[model samples]
Target chain A: MKQIVSPGCTTGPFFPVDFSDGSEDLSQRNGLAAKGQHIILTGHVLELGGKPARNMVVEIWQADASGIFRHPLDPRQQDCDPGFWCWGRARTDADGVYRFTTIIPGAYEDRAPHINVAILGIGLTRPLVTNIFFDARADVVFECVPAELRSRLLAKPEGDGVYRFDVILRGENETPFFVE
Target chain B: MMDDSTMKIDYAPYDDATQTLRQIDKYTPSATRVPSAPLIERPLTLSERTGPTELVSKWNVGKLDLCRLAPDSPRALGQLIHVTGRVTDEDGAPVSSVVMEIWQANASGKYIHELDDHRAPLDPNFTGQGRLVTDEDGRYEVFTVKPGAYPVLYSGWWWRPPHIHFSILGTSWMNRFITQIFFPGEVLNEKDLLLNGVPSRDVRDRLIFKPTDTVMGDLSYIGYQRDFVLRGHRQTPELP
Candidate 1:
């Protein structure tokens, strides 16, 4: 029963961002790379009218290759991959394409392999929450998603460890969103 | 399930009551991103339950103080204020260790960023960015300058009221609330598009923080308090 206390505002046209330190490349830390299939996750964010979202911040968090989370709340936090940064960030380009160099996350308890995403832009009004599933695996949450909408959550593998996942913020084929 | 122990991922579906309007008039709907389709709802699960708690180490360039970019830097040019708040759940349980951040314009309404084309002078000592985590009691305090209002070049170029942008990462990823904190009685609060976009007047008022009498030794600052209420139960799960 958590209620909305305050409605957030738009970021206008700018905020603070410094990605010069390779934060977008989450596949490796220092010189040691994470233990998993290195992959290129890239996608485009579009508005309902097919206009490309420009210069929006895109963040992704996922489990390591062992299906273990690095979060304190996870029961298996201690077992996480030491070399895995476990967090990635990217901003949409002029074409609205955001790219991240990450590892394929392992499936956790009752969930399929996936990466959680949060997006914010000048006109987004509010942050949008969603996930990029690796496949149509048998999972509780994936199955619970309305049958017709689950496809929007699944990422398309475009060969050679490269995946494509597009997000449509509103209107037809709007990527399914969630709130806990 | 797994090692038998005991745990359940209670999926929380989308609750529109507390959710922001996806298609608020000019504020959200734009050519680049609009609410052409209704939000398709789904149940929250492990994907949303577990979050990136191990932040700060990577993104924290500034700790709790925004009044000065660095310890030795001169005080930022503006009225210094102390912002304190707690993150709690619906049942009034403290949700500790929440990752929080604050970003705002300088006292002159200009951000310390490249995209800001506004003519306001940038305070070399004020980066306008600070990052921190709620303490064990789900409480946090940040020392920053009262940000100045800037004009939004949307249509007729209306001026946005002075506000602080807050990004909250609750226990769960889905509770990632990105909002702003406005000072009570700001003249612009009545016309701010994003603030008034909120459907309820009572809830809209919640966005404004209350003034409190606070002092730190010889240095006194205008103190404000606002508590954020997130969703779900917060008691830590019993370890197996």
Candidate 2:
């Protein structure tokens, strides 16, 4: 029997009941307000057969370096940067390309944590959530994620404020994605 | 072996992550040659419960403008009802300029997402995605194909019945909603811990199915209508 790694389906639901839509105009200020620096984190969603995965919903939520979320319900609004909503969502195209344009988040006291993503495709009972961290803080943040996602946190900073990370769904070196 | 009329399986173009085939890999001999499953007929009448329906109002429309369904979009089953509607704050106004992204499987149960690659080819005509600005009337339209039934990795098990995943963001940074919209009359709805967690029947009813409308355009697309109400201390938040 092939071993399947993943704690039973429940990845704590982060769905924002207050706001469920995914269309945010680019004109509005993104999570990083002052820091003109932005990174384009893009990747393709491929099926087990290696074809582009289309129409899959990809959601990402993270705290500003100051640990503030865009959610109004967030109780600890301390250091909440008005400039940073700190969360975004996108759908993968037929080519499986899903991209997010935002600023490099600063670290929080929560221990060098990184942004997390959850991908909910068809057929699964639960959603597949994963995390991505800054290369510099990989060591500290590595432990913040579960053992399964630790391997997939590897991200190479491509030139021009863009980082490239590929999500591997299966295999011996399979990478698991995470979310808080 | 030379007498065989079989051809070699081309695995080169596929990425390394996908080439590894194991028993779990549904795409082996059955995966590639698998014929498209027949779409389920939508249901007759879905009982609507009461309470707060998970609302999906647009906040911000992002750089990704395309909202066409993927080829993998489940053929609409007569039994499955789709419910799509616009969400706004307390004020009866539409929040325009937003994108509504949804994912689901066909009646046979399959998600169009690439990760669910074993089931269906990405529906070229169906994006399983849509975009809209609340009409001047605070209304938004969702154009998508119904979802299908598919598989998942749980405790040595499989699930049935088709459902949809919804992610709605505002036109600005203030509010965003992420939710899953389930079809009515599904036995799985009761089994689905998430669906039962909602407090009220009214809210749960909002997640039920309805017919797609062609008022926006044509009936070729599956349409589900529902309205989202985002209440807060104030009205719409300005774009940050």
C-alpha DockQ of every model: 0.49, 0.06
TM-scores, each model vs. reference: 0.87, 0.44
Model 2 alpha-carbon miss at residue A66, Å: 3.1
Q: After superposition, how far is residue A151 of candidate 2 from its true place, in Å?
A: 4.8
What residue runs in model 1 are displaced by over 4 Å at the alpha carbon? A1-12, A19-22, A145-151, A171-173, B1-19, B28-34, B56-63, B214-218, B234-240
Compute the lDDT of residue A160 as modeled in candidate 2. 86
Q: So what's the TM-score on candidate 1?
A: 0.87
Per-structure clash totals for the candidates: 3, 95
Model 2 C-alpha RMSD to native: 17.7
User: What tens-digit string does per-residue lDDT give for candidate 2 at A1-180?
Assistant: 211111111111222222323422121354535343567877876655556555555666566545444433333545556565455667666687888776655554443545656564432223455557766453444554455545566667889877777654543334553221
Q: Which candidate is the best by lDDT?
A: 1
Q: Write the per-residue lDDT of candidate 2 for residues B185-238, one digit (tens) a residue.
A: 777676544454444565556555555554434344445665664321132334
TM-score of chain B of each: 0.86, 0.52
The stretch of ten residues in a row with the least summed lDDT in candidate 2 chain A is A2-11
